[model samples]
Target chain A: MTRVVARVIVTPKPVVNDPQGITVKQGLATLGFREVEDVRVGKYIEVSMEAESMHEARERVDAMCRQLLANHIIEDFHFEVDQVLHRDTHR
Target chain B: MTRVVARVIVTPKPVVNDPQGITVKQGLATLGFREVEDVRVGKYIEVSMEAESMHEARERVDAMCRQLLANHIIEDFHFEVDQVLHRDTHR
Candidate 1:
């Protein structure tokens, strides 16, 4: 099996309301970053697993996103799957 | 002024413990994603701002990361700065 690492980025859909973004924007302004016009916050997840091939790895990661990693109603998700050498439980 | 968007990704240091990731890994396992070996969670932040140049934008965002976006003691961060067009308060 090929060791694969998938990096997933989950972002709120454009139509969703994100008060966290607003709070961060205000915080930046208070920190003297007045040039900042907007801010959006999202989640980044990295998963390492063993798969048969790159294609299978990507497919499995996509399924993981749909099933649990992302909330489809309010979030849009994407990921990059790559082959990694060795198997280390701690990263 | 140039309209710039800086995408910041903050990940926990390799040495730091990530219980959230562990919980997610267990959750995935319970969901029959038994091939998964490990998981890690982080933050994805998008910041849109005005700057004189790409270099300036990157520098400013780096400062923002150092100041508020990330905790250097336990996290590591990197960002990509790009030129964007127009201005929409929501997106």
Candidate 2:
């Protein structure tokens, strides 16, 4: 089996209100970072899996993201799948 | 002024206990994703800023991450800074 690592990023839809992002933007302003604008907060998920190939790994990770990693109603998810070397395997 | 977008990813240190990750891993197992392993949860933050140059923008975002976006004690943060096109500006 091939060991693969998937980095998934889940972000709120543009129309959705991101209270956390707003709070952070305000915090930045308070810190004298007035130049900062349009801050968006999201979730980053890393999944390591054993698959037959990179294609299979990507498909499985995509399914995982859609099923649990992200709420499709308000969030959009994207991911990158890469084969892991023996030295890079966490387990 | 240059419009730049910074994507920051924050993950817990390897030594830190991530309850969220453990929970997710359990969920995956229950869902019959036995091939999955070492699931980690983290935060992804995107910040758009106006600066004089790309170098300045990167420095500012790095400061922002260090000051408020990430807790250095238990987390490690990395970011990618890129120039934003006119059409990509959120505001």
Q: Which candidate is the best by TM-score?
A: 2
True contacts kept of each: 0.91, 0.83
Interface DockQ per candidate:
0.89, 0.87
> Candidate 1's residue-wise lDDT over B9-81, tens digit each?
9999988999989999999999999999989999999998999999999889999999999999999998899
- Clash count in backbone of candidate 2: 0
Two-chain DockQ for model 1: 0.89
Task: Tell me candidate 1's interface RMSD.
Answer: 0.5
Instruction: List interface RMSDs for the candidates, in order.
Output: 0.5, 0.6
What is candidate 2's CAPRI-style docking category based on DockQ? Answer: high
The superposed Cα distance between candidate 2 and the true structure at residue A33, in angstroms, equals 0.7
Give me the runs in candidate 2 sitting further than 4 Å from their true place: A88-91, B88-91
Tens digits of lDDT, candidate 1, A9-60: 9999988888989999999999999999889999999998999999999989
* Residue ranges of candidate 1 with Cα displaced over 4 Å: A86-91, B86-91
**RMSD to the hidden true structure, all candidates:** 2.1, 1.9
